[model samples]
Target: MTANASVFVEKLRSVVGDKGLVTDARARHPYLTDWRENYLGTALAVVRPATTEEVAAVVKVCAAEKVAIVPQGGNTGFMGGATPDESGREIVLSLARMSRILEVDTIGYSMTVEAGVVLKTIQEEAAAHDRLFPLSLAAEGSCTIGGNLSTNAGGVQVLHYGNARQLVLGLEVVTPAGDIWNGLRALKKDNTGYDLRDLYLGAEGTLGIITKAVLKLWPKAKDVATSWIAVPTPDAAVELLSGAHAASEDNVTSCELMSRQGIDLVLKHLPGAADPLTDRHDWYVLLEWSSTRARREAGNEGGLTEKMEGYLGEAMEKGLVLDAAIAQNEAQARAFWALRENHSEAQKREGPSLKHDISVAVSRIPSFMREGLAAMKKVLPEGRPVPFGHVGDGNLHFNCQAPAGWDKARFMKHGDAISRAVYDLVVSYGGSISAEHGIGRLKVDELAHYRSKIELDVMRTLKRALDPQNIMNPGKIVRV
Candidate 1:
């Protein structure tokens, strides 16, 4: 290490101890890249602080040296938000060692936790307290709460509970200037001054580092019903969901849409993942309804399954559903959900792919897919389109896997053109090019191009005002 880097390392070690720092190249490799393997960066050192006070101390050292700090949590982000740059001058501030569950207020329906705590752990803890923390995604086993708040992640349950931002009540953040902002209040309504908690929630750690959070919770579901249905088209799936709200009495927890192509990939790659139905169809929907009340009887009177069956029968009569299967038990329900959750892993194993997390108005998803797929095929005729996601909330992972037997270098040649076409179509439909994933150097150019000038100006102004030195995750959402 250079003399300056040696000095910085010593100061960081003094604050977090020798065991908390990782300087060896091999030990630091995983933290240098994102989950998608799209970015392999370099860092001077990876600092693992075990406490909020230690985190502030490390930030103080970086702020004094004018060195950039890349705040990372679990490094599970798809947009490369937590990865450092190739310049080997930046220090990676990893929060893996700081995981702790501080409090669980069952009566108040809130959970207070450190930033490094895994999401699944939080869910389990809430369940132990007879409560529920509903923010869930595929990577919940490994993804951290800090990163979830940083990206404002959206999962299947967004159809009912909303996004990560809505699930959080307050946050505790460490500013770029090495100061702590303690706003971790479990208040249901805080009408004080500005909502500083929001400013740090979706900033992707560019504005500040999230150290802790006060998350909202709800009562656990006592009775649940899940279904796997074959829909003839995207429009049919939408119509089915529209009719389900009234039928399910607003208990629809999740409603995911998938193409037959995506389901085939899941069956091919994911072990133990079986197709729920025997007959293959062009489109399918994974519908789930959860209720806080227990079942009144074994059959029809007030059972969740009976209500779901009734809805499916009505939908079939209207041609909205071609075929359907309601899960007989929890195991069957999980088996059905495995098909939807394993989509990304299966796609990765298949080949190089272009994944776009775009969104449009709920009614315009069908038209968007029609034009977007055509535009993509016009560019790469042999591309394999795997379009699926939380269609109930209007977000679709409109991804395209590389053609069969095509290498990464070869398939990526058509990536730019395909992405441009899809993004253009999304813009025309008055939709977002990015729904949950932030810019995070992946879509920086697209964000600049698609977002209005005034909007970009306001974001840049906030970034500059809060993180004036540009030491907090530089070259992320903005180019300030």
Candidate 2:
């Protein structure tokens, strides 16, 4: 190590104590690579801070030494936003030790938590208090709230509760210069000035480190009804969603789409997986509706399950749905959701594939899927498309799998061209090349190419103003 780097590590170790600093290569391996193993980086050291004050102190030392800092949470992010670069000069600031639930205000319907708290812990705590924290994802068991806020994560419930950004009411951030911005207000009417909280919420740690957050909560649902429906085409699924909303008074909590190829992969790779419907269809949708009212009271108003059944019956009568199966109980509902959540894992077992997390307007999802699939096929006729995700929110994980008997490496050689073809179509439809996942390192160039001059300039200006030294998560979001 360089003389300056040695001195910087000593200072960081002093602030975090012996247990907080990890310098052994083997111990640091997990933090260096991304979840998908797509990005592998080296860092000077990994530091864990237990409190907001400790985080600020660590940042102060790093800033003084002019060292770049990469604030990492659960490290379950799809993009390489939290991984350090190859230089081995950046410090990996891990928040695992800072996990804590500082406060929970049931009356205000909000909770304040330290950044390191696991998302599932928050959800459980909220439920214990008879409230609900609706921000959920496949990795909620390990992913932290800080990472969710940094990436602006969206999951199955985004159709009802909104993304991580909408669920957060305030934040306590440690600026790049080692100053704390205590904007952790629980007020819902804070229109006082420039909304700094929103700026940092999805900045991917480029501007500052989110140490804590005040998150919004809702009443726990008393009844939840889940259904798996088969549609002849993507357009029919879209039409069915419209009819469901109209019939259920917008109570649709989750609406996910799955292609026949995706389902086949799940059934083949995931043990205990079963086909939810009797007949096979080209496309399918898994949807649910929830109500917080008591079951007896809810039943008096025909209940959420009855309403969902009525909606599906109407959709089937109109030919929007070809077949349907509604879960009879909670166990069955969970079984239906297991198929949707196991998609990523099942695809991993199948083979290496190129994944794209992109979105378009909800109304244009059908057209985007149709056109995007054709564009991708033209690039690689042998590639199989596994297009599925939250159709109600228009975000699709449009992934491409290698054809049978083809080598994974050889198939991946065409990944760039296939991605370009699909992304170009996304741009043509006035859609986002990235939906829930932030830009990180993977989409930096694409963001530069697609974003307008004015938009890029404004982003750069903000980065420079907040982090003049560029010591906080450099080379992320914007290249300022």
lDDT of 1 by residue, 380-446 (tens): 9999999999889999999999999999999999989999999999999999988887779799888
- Which candidate achieves the best lDDT against the true structure? 1
Which pairs of residues collide in candidate 1? none
- lDDT for each residue of candidate 2 in 191-224, tens digit (9 for 90 to 100): 8889999999889999999999999999999878
Candidate 1's C-alpha runs over 4 A off are: 297-302
What stretches of model 2 exceed 4 Å from their correct place?
A: 298-302, 405-408
- Which candidate number has the best TM-score? 1
Error of 1 at 311 (Å): 1.0
